[model samples]
Target chain A: MSHGYQAVGWSPFKKRYDLVLGGLLAGYLALFSLATLLLRPEITAETLLIRAFGTAALLLLHAVLAIGPLARLDGRFLPLLYNRRHLGVTMFLAALVHGALATFQFHALGDAPPLVSLLASNTRLDSLSQFPFQQLGLAALLILFLMAATSHDFWLAQLTAPVWKALHMGVYLAYALIVAHVALGALQDERSPLLAGALGAGVVAIAGLHLAAGRREAALDRERRAAGADGFVEVCGVDEIAEGRARVVTLGGERVAVFRYEGRLSALSNVCRHQNGPLGEGRIVDGCVTCPWHGYQYLPASGASPPPFSERVPTFRVRVVDRRVFVDPRPLPAGTPVAPAVVSESGGGG
Target chain B: MTPLDVATWIVRLAGAYAAAGLLFALLFLFVLRGVDRIDPSARAGSRGFRWIVLPGVAALWPLLLRRWLAGASEPPEESNAHRRAAAGGRG
Candidate 1:
């Protein structure tokens, strides 16, 4: 039997039906539970199922949001990135259930259908604690619905990458609204300190992860600027690099790696395209620079060719003037990464 | 079957289905970890957290009351046999 091990990579395929059905089931279950709770029906086996599902779904949403920063912080968690859409859609469905049950029980009874009641109910908008958290849930659900609908590659292809990315950013807005919904609706009535603390912790953890990532990115930017060849006044001797050793230099606003081999020096873009790994920290292995993180190798001479993969980094022209290496700030074409470009004692004398 | 028998069967069926759903959900909790492993992109960690923490506490709760009132004992008999065998071996 052929072990049909599907090559595990980012699945380009969208799970439209799973999201759709899951959303419907969650919405119905929530409405049913809310209706019974408001009516004060005897606590039956059905009530137990509803409570468990609601609790589980709420926890899952928090887990899903945490996965994004967790993955970015560590590459091992990249697996979560590939299936992020599934988690998001599933959580949306769960929240929908809670919303639906709520609408049916609280809003529907003596008026138009539950959906109409939700739309028409504007009486509680003025009050702080009395604000219809259901409306907030509705708004959040609408945003999630839009996101879940467009999560497929088909929709992604229809919407340009920029538009798709912009649309997906609505998740932050949805999350904010959901927080308000819970604070006003659930916590207001329940007054459970444990639940309130859990919510607070979730918000803090998610925000902290993003803030930490932003700080790291800012630091990387600083390092990139300092390492640029032009950032350093022509160092006393550009020829300071020992054979096979790479020197980090700054030129203009870009970081470049200057390496000496066979009495010649070459400059290459110091940033590894994969996660912006530090090319300076990497060592030359068989004439190829290997990234320390995932072992993505690039030819130091041309900055290309780790075959079956076709990505190129920019290279710069370097000239030695009285042992001082001067580099032209203009970047070479990405594919024209010339490995081991001839370095000379006189600027551009090669 | 009588109407009462049919009614009883329906109730039993519902209970069985609910139990099945619970069992499936528990198995899903474990299987999710498997799915997470098979498709590493699915979940974060191993699926045994339920067995390690939830099952022990939840399953033991009702058992505690059952044994408290009835003095239910079985493992003691098995252990007593082992103790007797050890003592006999020494004697």
Candidate 2:
């Protein structure tokens, strides 16, 4: 809750977070520069900066990508997810510096403009061994610049969350571009096993984390599908859903959150409207289903945000028979009001 | 035209577009209403927020225009009880 945005809604926590980040970044650059100067004294200062910033940006990008899956796997990593936009912006700046230095070093003072020079300097598009890796890097940088520019809440609001999310998914494309950029550009020039191994490990770590998290989510979906039948899916017994908690069931390829609150059962789409957050993982706060990711709330019965907030999610029809909860797999339109099923006195204790 | 000239022209055009976009974004921030729907905490007259989001709006103006034209910023209406009943409402 901000009533008005400042440059940033900085808190003590953010200040400390930024300070630690800056310290680590400065330390990495310094160590990298020192090592380069000592070990490879023949390397030019410009080359040194390029390599240092490029590697730093690559590492930061890895950290940025890792934070999402890490937070999903462990709650302790949620703090990193909170201020991730800042991390992304910083990574872009580092990448920008690397791009600037590289362009100046390689393409400046030529007959053609730097952009033209970059494109034409190496037209070896036909061969993988001699591919124009700089162009790949430039493409990735453009994507980063776009993402960095829009890494703000205002854009999220302006573009709508779904559209904004889809746009940012371009990061994956940018990441692939960068991997090719490195493999065909820097790694080709320098045949260092250590550098190649680090890049491979980073790719493996990112891929492995995403796979693990996806498998976990898939297993939950499998369990739900195995228990249900036909269009009406049997979720669980009323007693299984604790008061103010929910049991998430996957029906018809979508996750539905069946929540029990005040001895009433209601089901709504599991995806949070704000960031596609898991609503089932969140508890009902103030008579609304609050997303654990950003605390955006929606009324369980109507799937509407409380007055003054405009977000909504699809609601599902739920009924209780002999303490077993059954949900209609077909979803009603977002914000559709559905009646809550009242729990019988003999059903379960709240 | 040679490949070099074509590439140079493309770069120049891109630069011009970026400059025009920045100007348009500034105008949109100052002149338009109902543009800032994502952050309720953002004050309508906050120059700080405007400056922060200017670059993003410039880069993504087309997407923003589509959203604005589609009336995506408007708040969702509360469904009436009769309408809810028609949709198979339990309540």
Candidate 3:
């Protein structure tokens, strides 16, 4: 939301969020380490720390993955979604600590390099029970490293938002690798039903939440409005949309948000330019349509961000006739300014 | 080849790719060209920003290199369902 990029874009809210997260992370690691020590005094410090960080990372990864579906299902969790990159980067750091320590402990003394030893030492492909799982963990770490490196808006702007998003979608692949790494490595070694149960529960919970959100989205897409002659679709009653708000309707395989403000109706593509956020879900602020995800603003008339910002979304011609809002299914070029259809002008077939 | 041998080759190849990426990033960030031409916002990005972006540059060096070599001065236009629909208006 700025013309220029800063190192970290540090803000008051980000500072507070990071502080709270730091406190929680430290507390969790301390508690895990204490519990492990009390339960097994025979364990060495390195082993204890590795397990503590590894479990912490796994738990954090689940939280990171769950936050998306949770936010989609409920707006209350949107704050978590806002700074999820921080959560993901924190998870990667925790995982890096676990990986570095484990490598040092397990392979440092070998004649080959630590990475070489890690890859060459474990060759138990003969049995599923003894398969090499460190490779899986390492692979996941590499993906996370790449993701964390490119998490900033600099990359988003450089690579284009869609490409950046596609790259970050590697998170799902990393998640799968991590699940396999744990199920085959730690669970095999520990042989603890409780551990197994926790893993299963996490996977199920994440999957279930995603499916629930997907169902809700599918329902929205199903309510596509029937278009009439002149390529205009009658979406909803003008009274249905509150002032400074929008009613999103699917038309011609695209979602358009018809917004009402100051007795005038305007239509814009539902997608925001920054992150493809739902502009329909956001309300007008300071006479501008503000995005719900990151507050990226666009003018309802031109579907363009105000001066100093060049981003734009497609604007559709819209009018209200007989108190029913009708929008043209074909969108105008982005940033094209069209006179808003006033309520009184509707009688003239505006 | 055995699974282990296959894995070792993959790891070695990836490692070499990363090493090359890191070296290329160092030159690209410092000597090759200014980011202002590629991206205006990165005109005077901070040291911390450059350090943080090293891994990303290492990972996507090939793409960046191609863009840089081709003298691409702006980011590509994003295409999506809405944009595709809008493109129909042009046709």
Which numbered prediction scores highest in lDDT against the true structure?
Answer: 3
lDDT minimum window of 10 residues, candidate 2 chain A: A223-232
How good is the docking of model 1, as DockQ?
0.01
In model 3, residue pairs whose N, Cα or C atoms come closer than 3 Å (at least 3 residues apart or on different chains), thus clashing, are none
- Looking at model 2, the pairs that clash are A2-B41, A3-B41, A4-B41, A4-B43, A157-B38, A339-B90, A339-B91
Task: Identify the CAPRI category of the predicted complex in candidate 1.
Answer: incorrect
- Candidates 1 and 3 compared: the better one by lDDT is 3
Give candidate 2 misplaced runs (Cα > 4 Å): A1-12, A222-232, A344-350, B31-45, B65-91
Cα deviation in Å at residue A308, candidate 3? 1.1
What's the lDDT for all of these models? Answer: 0.57, 0.81, 0.85
Cα lDDT tens digits for candidate 2, B1-91: 7767777888989898888778768766767743565334554437877888888878877766665567664423333222243356332
Assess every candidate by TM-score: 0.50, 0.86, 0.94
Q: What DockQ was computed for model 2?
A: 0.33
Clashes of 1: 20
Runs of candidate 3 exceeding 4 Å displacement: A344-350, B1-11
Q: Looking at model 3 chain B, which ten-residue stretch has the lowest summed lDDT?
A: B33-42
Query: Could you give candidate 1's per-residue lDDT for residues A1-350 as a string of tens digits?
Result: 01112222222333553454467556756775776577666766444453545554566667777776676577576545546666777777666675666665666585454555565555567798788677687888778877765554323322433456678889889889888977887688674497789889989998998888678646654743222545334432655677766777555455667767666776667666543445654567777776543355777667774664554566666666566665654556554655444656445434
